[model samples]
Target: MSVPALNRAPDAVTTRVTAPGSRRRPDIEGLRAVAALLIAVYHIWFGTVSGGVDVFLLLTGFLITGSLVRAMERDGRVDLAAFWTKLVKRLFPAGAVVLGAVLLMAYAYFPRSQWTTVIDDVWAAALYYGNWHLALGSVDYMAENSAASPVQHFWSLAVQGQFYLLWPLLVCGAALLAVRLGRSARRGAAVAVGTVFAVSFGYSLWITATAPVWAYFDTGARLWELALGGLLALFVHRVDLPGWARTVAGWAGLAALVLCGLVIGDSLPYPGYASLWPTLAALLIILAGAGTAANGRLSANRLLGARPLTWLGGHAYTLFLWHWPVLVLHLELTGLERPTPGGGLLVLGVSFAAALATSWMVDGGVSRATRRLRTPAWSLAAGVLFVVPVLVAGSLWAQSIERDRQLRTELSSNPLAYPGAAVHLDQDLARNLPSLPVYPDTTTVARDTIDQTRACNALIDQTEVVTCEFGDPRSDYTIALVGSSHVRHWFQALETLADQHGWRLVTMTKNACQFSSGEQRYRGEVFTECAQWNDGVMAALDELEPDTVFTLASLTSVRSGPEEHVPEGFVERWRQLDARGIDVVAVRDTPRFSFRVPDCTDRNHRSECSEPASHSMAERAPYLELDDVPANTRFLDMTGYLCQDDVCHGVIGNQLVYYDTNHFSYSFSQSLAAVMEPYLLEAAGRAPEAELTLAEAALSPEEAAEAAREHDGSS
Candidate 1:
């Protein structure tokens, strides 16, 4: 629920008495109750979009805009300070209480690794920019699999809060312009709002098509819904439809609102043309009920004005605020992806109980205090009282993050502290290793893999091939590290070889984008950027005429099931590169896990976190096809370093293996430099020199002897 709209309803009841032609519509309150219930039910049980949020957005625009216009029409000017003060008093207290509770719950129940995200979200929601934060997160693949934050629902509230702040200023400007131009203030306001609606709607359509994931939480994409509501508010007072027309419109709109969720699944792109169904339906219901008597007739208002709904509506804001966090926390605690019917009902019951207590105790107290205080200064003070605690908590969390960074920096400086995957290869060294919390710690694990020195990985949205040169830049033997981050992570091992073998190493990479010749799908959208980037990469490769192009040969498809296959595009790209006399060295992609390895290892034992290596490597056979393609093509599998006989470990040799779910931790990958050097040399047709083997390179004779002694004792 939009806190301002729901919280202001009681004030509107008193204020409406002085305004002409204004009567309290219990039906709108009832509708709010229905919207809130639908949102809660869909989120907790169905795990789908219910169009309830769109209804709230529409109601927010309609009610707030209507109230502002009525004030302007009666007083001829808007008292912006008084308006803002009232809003702060109405909204802040309940929001602040919820934020404080959520923060405490998070710190107590959530993993330390997730504390930063929760704190960041707390700050964003407090500042009314949570929508942008969520929008950015939606496009990030790494964050896509993260457990839903308890405050994720606050994105809508943030949107509403922003609209609340900006709409009054807009209405005030329109009112002034109308006086200067000798025009109707309401009409001028309608025109201005309509213009904004058009521009926002156009942008929404474009963005939804191009980047629907981001569009889902974008404030710009959502403004049209709010503007539509404002337009209805401006005109509803002037319209006087007959009872029969109202009956038809009311029933149809009610039906549309009820079926919208079932008909338009949550998976579908929304707030574009798809949103018109719900927003327009809501507008119809509001317009149809206007000026209608609430007698026991067949009118929509009469049906909606039932006492129960209005009671729920009275507590809608609190219910909306409390339900999401309750649901998310419940799921996190229970380890259930979704609750059963009984569990969902229990969750809803608890949420409603909490909402009632907060609504009466917290919101009721704030409302009463605001009435007694009345002054802007007291309201400002009340706002500060609400906001200060959350800011203080956020500051403490930020400091903790800085401290973790410092610890990680200190630990990282000692090479012996994190020998990474090398410990698995040398059992002696493994036996002699000191105890340490997995290097890269949960705070830094997300970025533990891949090179940081090079700005060569193009973002998911970019179509350019970012290139960076490493290792023997002037050498005659050129080996281009090309593909997505999977290939980029191998640069640690390959860079070691390049330095040892005198080869020029060039990196061509894009984030989550594989070097495919055909179109690919990313986050359910056509990866036009990836395809375009590949074209650029191919052209660059031709120009550079690199001796060998190292990229991913095969990947496991998570879309359909756990089937491994050589992507048609990868095969096609390989053939093209081979035709250009570029040796295609395809490194088999690593095993991907269903859960985050670092988080799993942090919470559970290594045995509990391990998965069947065979199941993960079921797709390994597809890489064998690379042998049939051409003489220039070479296939390399490094799974031996990553997995054991039957199981794959989250931690190897006292170092965290995977950073997230699939990507290797940088330290782990660096540990594999010795193991991977021989294969890399053979792939590039270079023989190993008189340098030590992987074990010999990393372990001295004394340390090796001590490790052997420990291993013998353990045996």
Candidate 2:
């Protein structure tokens, strides 16, 4: 959303003046309206980049910088205090109202599991750092599937607010320097702003190429768009384009703006050279209005300054704030990933009504009431007084959720009460159900499956193999755990066996990087790091000469439905390890869900929170064929423990089964240690050949018959 940079002084001249080099341009207001509408439509229905935000950034630079320069020219000094006072009074009221509304809705409608995230987003948006928060989230693989925050649109507003705070200081400094040098203030400011544009644009191109996700929200990468507007402000007045030339340029720019969304999808890296299209288009439209009559022949201004468009433009800031949250809430409530046509229309209608009312009641009303507070200190105090409580409340809400989550984890740590998956299969299903208040509450689930706290898992971007050892380091029997997070999550189960058997356990894992010879893709980029890390892992394994290697056998292809198979490259790695006399134990991958399991269980009963085993399982026929692998290689399937009777429940044996959609909860994995120990020992050729103990022996025929009769009668 763009900050409305139109002059807001009650006594200022109407923005419709057509005088030569006039301060007001009605076309800019219409451009703001157009940009706001484009962004709303793209977000709600098209799901593409409209380049509307770039248009807003350019407009913000042109309008705000132009106003400051004119003030310096007329008064011989910029009124920084008055400028900030007016800006704050104009912007903060509407933003604060929206933030408060979003917080209320989050508490009332969203699941408590998401409360901490919502509160943190609110805090970030309120303090104008929401963009950075989102930028960090984009890079974190763990946060990849998180639902979009309702206030995510606030990132653009944060960028604008940051610029509002910094741009004026730069302009004032440049003006002062110009006065000392006997040069025009506007020219000196242009030179300074131009340098910022050039440097920032260069950085934007490089960063967008290397790290597009971060570049999308980075202020430094975005500064060039605003700087382009500032440069236009400085020079537009000096341009003497002929009427024909202005008309041609205006239409060309308008055509480009209208087609931007269709031509440039969100899949393309943004704010790089691609951003120049919209910013340059906006500049053309603004320049075309310089000398045109309101209804002149071939005039872009006449078309842009129409009554309906200007009305929408006047309320653009409020529209930008209200539309996104409404759209997000609509999707959540209706359970539609994309809006239906009827729902889309309803969202737009509601957003328009809200924007219209808020623009008048909060934005316009606050500005008028606060106009009497002429001193900057008084204005600052009023703004702080209005905003600080909301910020504090948001921060406190996040802290409170964290505290409650920590308390739950502490209270639920009873080993006897929560023996996890360690209990006998029959006893677990019959008596040792999941505990109350669930282990790994929503606030902790994201981190609950992680073994990196012990420094066993490699960082996502690192190619070097980092090993963390557990159990007896000097043990002759060595078992190396290798591959991606899927392999690492199993370490919690294996650690117990390693200790009991006096085996040295070595873990080498990289985030989401499987040990396959095939190419890997992470966040849509070719993952060269995975390939490099695999090379290091092979060398390390060769040197260590581990007796056994444990890793994932198959991965389910989400896009291909229930299909699962070993990647060709995985077979290559397995053969290499087999040649080195390292026996391989490949465990079947766990069933994955489309939604977060803890969240599902929190919202629904255990019986209601299950998926069909048939759908969740990879096509098993291929895995069964792996029986013909090298003599040293063995495959294990433990799906029966995770799923029963063609259905897989999210919670098993009174314990949460997964920390997220796929990874096992640490406690649940620990529980599985008992079930896994025998297989691991067998794989290592160390299973004891002793007669079974009474408790461990299979039931005799008469006893089994009696148990079956009892179960039938109970059912």
Instruction: List lDDT for all candidates, in order.
Output: 0.76, 0.75
lDDT of 2 by residue, 392-466 (tens): 778787788879878867866775555555434344233424336666676666655553433666666678998
696: Cα error in model 2, Å: 6.0
Q: Model 1: how far is 610 from its true place, Å?
A: 1.3
**Candidate 1 residue runs with Cα over 4 Å from true position:** 1-21, 292-296, 447-455, 471-477, 495-504, 523-526, 558-562, 619-621, 625-627, 685-687, 695-715
Q: Each model's TM-score?
A: 0.91, 0.89
Count of clashes, each model: 0, 7
